[model samples]
Target: MNAEGKAGGFAPGVAKAEGALRALFPETPLQENDYLSKKTGARVFLKREDLTPVRSYKLRGAFNFFRKAIAGGATDGTFVCASAGNHAQGFAYVCRHFGRRGIVFMPVTTPQQKIDKTRIFGGDFVEIRLVGDFFDDCYRAAHVFAAESGGMMVPPFDHPDIIEGQATVALEIARQMHGESDARIGDSLVILPVGGGGLASGVTCYLRESGEPTEFAFAEPAGAASLQQALVEDRPVRLAQVDNFVDGAAVAEIGAEPFSHLQDFDARAVHLVPENRLCATMIEMLNIEGVVLEPAGALAIDALKNYAPETLRGRTVVAVVSGGNFDFERLPDVKERALRFEGLKKYFIFRFPQRPGALRDFLDLLGPEDDITRFEYLKKSARNFGSVLIGIETRNRANFDVLTQRFDKAGWAYQDITENDTIAGFII
Candidate 1:
């Protein structure tokens, strides 16, 4: 039970865990974000976990896991773990920190940026093995490696030591918030992003234990609402499909160990953020505040949109900006998702009449502010009617409604394939 942590409040030895973390790095900042504060009419502070050594709070867990295992007489000094990007980098960082030999398993399809960062952090202390094409595959491979090699497997989020280590973020937040504000901790609200439930569980447990009566909100990826689903089913259930756009926070199944600390919460407290909407948040933060956040990092900020301005007015709220390992190469995709989510961009399939002036007639239906971004003939050889894929960008979402009406009036045979995943995947 000690390994899984106590059932109530702070996990056993979490205080010690926090103390151990101080040697690793200084506390990450809790800076007030004027942009978000004004937008929601709430005092918004961002816990800049994105500013950590590995650009994430993951190092805390990985370091503590290795420290505990080594201190507890599990010699041989070999450690292993599986991760997508952030966790691998964190584990590698911590391995180099302690000068310990480590093995990291990551997906073969993991971005080059992440792979290079992990290598940079580990230096000579860690070996990275690219296994399968997904996290699950790499995870299984890590387990098999540990089993055969008798190496200690450092779980990304499921172990008690990891949970305790993650709790250090809450400890820092408590101290930092109290120092920065004259108001009681109870007056403040804490919003956390949930992936495998490690960060949320640890922070919640620590807050409760430290006698903070603060309000709490959990932000989850809409495509992978593992924590929300677990609360409903009263147990962890594997998701049928998981969108990995917010790769850091996308987990098919919530961790069993972390779930123990979070299972009793009200489902309403968990907000599911759409992938596209999260991209909008990322873009907003980057363009406005000059903060380049990964999709998972933006989840907590995006969840603030779930609350009305009136409800949040005058409230002091904190959001954990979970990570900033975003690859700039994906900027175009992020922009596209953001545009689509805002309704400023759309894709449509039109069955144009086989006439010489058909395109001219169709172009005339577009509003003044509308611009055609893509127009490709799906069947150029057709005689009677040809199918064409068209992508339109507009100044306003309302313009689309007006354009749809015009299309109907013109008797154009078209399908709004913007939201059609199947057609968009193949055609767009």
Candidate 2:
């Protein structure tokens, strides 16, 4: 059993991964991030695996797995796998590369944007099977197809070869950091986002075995801190609930193989980045730095706030930006979350009088920089008053204080529903 992170030994697979992956694609960039270095007081380098052909590092693992399968002289009848996003895309691309028939099983609910991209990448070489409404249905369908057709299922990250392939990211980082020499990279820290644990585990093991004293920090979306929970318990534990907002890095449980390599680490070191805060970082990168990062991809960048400047000063650090499978349709929500987290927006339910100029009175309270984005009348709660939903946006977060002060002076009865999840979920 290729236990998570190849507990018994993994150097073999990691060693071969470097060569096997080159045929599929070149090594992604290891960029010196001037913006991040200035922010964190560290010599920050970004292992830009997201710049791969598929815009994700998953291609390395997928290619390695396929190469190993064929190298072992396994019959290439059909290759089956279940995935809706990056994994499926990587699998399809690799299958096409090898001239092998590939069947990709994706949930029926997969975004059309993803489906179209996968089809475009694979062309006629791949056939996508839209299975049940959820992931379980898709997984079961893939397994059944594999069994009936004598095909092999390519797992996302649960295999030894996948782990080794994922480790190629680290290898590439090491190679890119040097000036085309046999000189090894000095001690550095690698900050990686943990989802299925494939990338984190593979990179960690490969660096350790390479005899590099690289410090490692694992980042997980707060809504899906599976690694953190598992480490604290000293056992692999499944989350009772998970938020799929950061779909790329939201896993209910870290892979068994990944757990083996990461089990010894302290739980505190596993930073849980708030999804909304990550959205803020995403917008900041897009607007200020022109870096487009998906929710999970921003995990490492968002986590920078947690580490003190002194802790990172003068040290070379690398962050693995995992994938960029962001669906733009979610951008509005992302923006709203970002605004809320950054304190630039707020929502309130106001009880205003039905008398004339009541609306003007409320409007008068808004500062010069404040803009009312949403205003709706729900119903009359009393003969003299009605309930209204109000959303306000401002250039400065402090504008809310002035707005609230005006409300208090004007005898306005209001409930702050910006953070009222029940109301926001139903109405907003």
Candidate 3:
């Protein structure tokens, strides 16, 4: 594949960026995984961006932004960015690498582990500031601080420098494929996980420039499908609400610059990965392959399920594992989500008779495989009945169908609140 014609369209810039990246760390590995290959009936390669210096590809973009700012005569010696997780860590790592002062404003609600990781990465080169409870609040504070202190503000995405830096990942892929003896680089499928679209945009541009006849697919969290929305509207639109479960990739709005590069792709090429289903993918990787992945990191891998085995049979596919900064504290929640998505767990609101024997009667309906995970009584609605919240976990999903039938036959009143977001939000 020829990469000589293009100068600015991710070809020249990304090549230079790739050379510069060697100063910080070697290229992340692109290893073929037998597990995914067997599942899809395709040769699957994982671009393990999770193994990056900051445990994400975010370092590539942040480093490039700082490098250009310093080299292009930016007078400000301090850099500032607002992030709750991966971006903060990346920016801090780059600050330390370049011996520059950095101020990272993060939400007060950010986990201690993430905050500590950012501090460890930046060491003496960066200052951590806890601002507001939400990302928007801290983002506003970061802008104000940057303006007041005359510090250069680095955006998590939305900048050309950041995009170019991220394009280096694609450049590495092209180079690595070229070196592989059995790899068919030209006919491969490249699956990218879309956050703000920086990584996807950059990689697509570079791969096109490299003249690789590769097919591209994008995966976005269903609750935060900013990229898909942008493509649909032919312009970027801010979502009223975005689920932050896939924190690394949950963007309410796609970046303008990235959208410009990515808008050409067809809407059908993007897959919306459900947050709950993503938990299953994350657990599968962890339990089977010993790979720990954050929600967004599992996006591309989960997307492989979108295609049938026949469609991908004998094909070479690459899934970008975006990051691995998963907090073990959230493991229980991850497992719960996975079970719920798999239909092995459910929540119910039951009207129990206000009698001593009523509780025992309800418990008697349970099968041998059924277990009560949570049971709480709400306020009594009447003198004879009380509202009870019950969470059930079963070995088989079929048990729920039988249990519901038994409840109906016994004239027991119950409401399945497992998928009622509003009710679950308040009490669960």
Candidate 4:
């Protein structure tokens, strides 16, 4: 069946929401990228949602939510939301714009950059409270605060109004693609990053409802594959643990409301991007295109690597760049991760003899291209031997193979701890 036939009833509401959004900000540009196109053999276009006034498409939903709430005679004029990243900034911006008092509950672990930006956007109109270390913790706190304080809770996702707001991105995409002439929505592939599933569900539902024959793909952080797990279990389930490295998209659970819209999608349509690999994409975009992208912003672009050239060749592909609220303070960590993922850097723990020539013997085993980046004598495990922590960097990945071979031949007592998160976390 055609998309419009199945989702026709949903299209008009999305279109209406899109029309309302114009009063707030102009449509974000959809630019065709030569770099990505050349790499993937596709006519790659980036829907620059990162260029939104709040540096993410999140404000669209928040604005729509506030508009509907006010129109519905919500006289309290108070709003509450929980977010550790883009959603909090969007909610704060909307609250300020509407001149309504707002309370934002963010995780205590949220980056200072996000916290400061949220405060700046809201100004005196919003109050930010640091709750627990993860989003779910703050989310529960926000709910309790909303009920006790008689405030309307504006969820990051999982609400009809928020979904409608986010669907406006699809409306804009359709119109923009039509104007491009060479890009046809019917023949395009749209890649969206999934967090709580708001952006992905909204964009997919809208395009489907419009009866466009557009194909959809989703990108999710590998450490927080909530949407993928949901598809597998046939329901939303909270993860026992979540890695917040990709803090913007590190949702522990997919929202039930968003999952209802996304449940029918095939599991193959989703790509889980490794957190370290995502760092490489972020670095690539920054260095090559001079584009700054947050981890979540790079998710869709990074997922393009998972597609075979044959699948994307001759097709127009649209990947949403979700946000660019990256803090410069995190650059060192990003570069470190990128190097590790690219196999150009590694850490090792070595047991070295305390004799005079022991250090010289180890240094002699290194390849010409390999450079020592770190060396520290951890402790003397025995009277004649000491534990040494070493970090190495090389221009090529093959250098590590050669170096390891040399170590094995020389009978060096060393353990490669690069992949040991537990050990690395404690010392490296």
Q: Residue 364 of candidate 2: its Cα lDDT?
A: 80
| lDDT per model vs. reference | 0.89, 0.86, 0.92, 0.90
Candidate 4: segments with Cα more than 4 A from true spot: 1-8
What is the per-residue lDDT of model 3 for residues 1-428, given as tens digits with 9 covering 90 to 100?
11322444558878887889999999999999999999999999999999998889999999988888888887456899999999999999999888899999999999999999999999999999999899999999999998988989999889888988898889888888888888867889999999998899889988887787899999999999999999999999999999999999999999999999899999999999999999999999999999999998999999999998899999999899999999999999999999999999999999989988898899899999999999999889999999999999999999999999999999999999899989998998
Give me the candidate number with maximum lDDT.
Answer: 3
Q: What is the TM-score of each candidate against the true structure?
A: 0.95, 0.95, 0.96, 0.96
Per-candidate RMSD, Å: 2.0, 2.5, 2.4, 2.7
For candidate 1, the clash count comes to 0
Q: Rank the candidates by lDDT, best first.
A: 3, 4, 1, 2
Candidate 4 lDDT by residue in tens digits, 1-428: 12222464767777777888888799999999999999999999999989998999999999988887888898565799988788889999988888999999988988788899999999999999999977779989999988987899998888878888898888888999999867798899999999999888889888887788999999999999999999999999999898988888988999988999999998888999999999999999999999999999999999999988898899899999999989889999999999999999999999989999888888888888899999998999999999999999999999999999999999989999999999999999
Write candidate 2's Cα lDDT for 367-395 as tens digits.
Answer: 89999899998899999999999999999
RMSD of 3: 2.4
* Residue 200, candidate 2: C-alpha displacement in angstroms: 0.5
- Which regions in candidate 3 have their CA more than 4 angstroms from the true location? 1-9
List model 1 lDDT by residue over 274-303, tens digit each: 999999999999999999898999999999
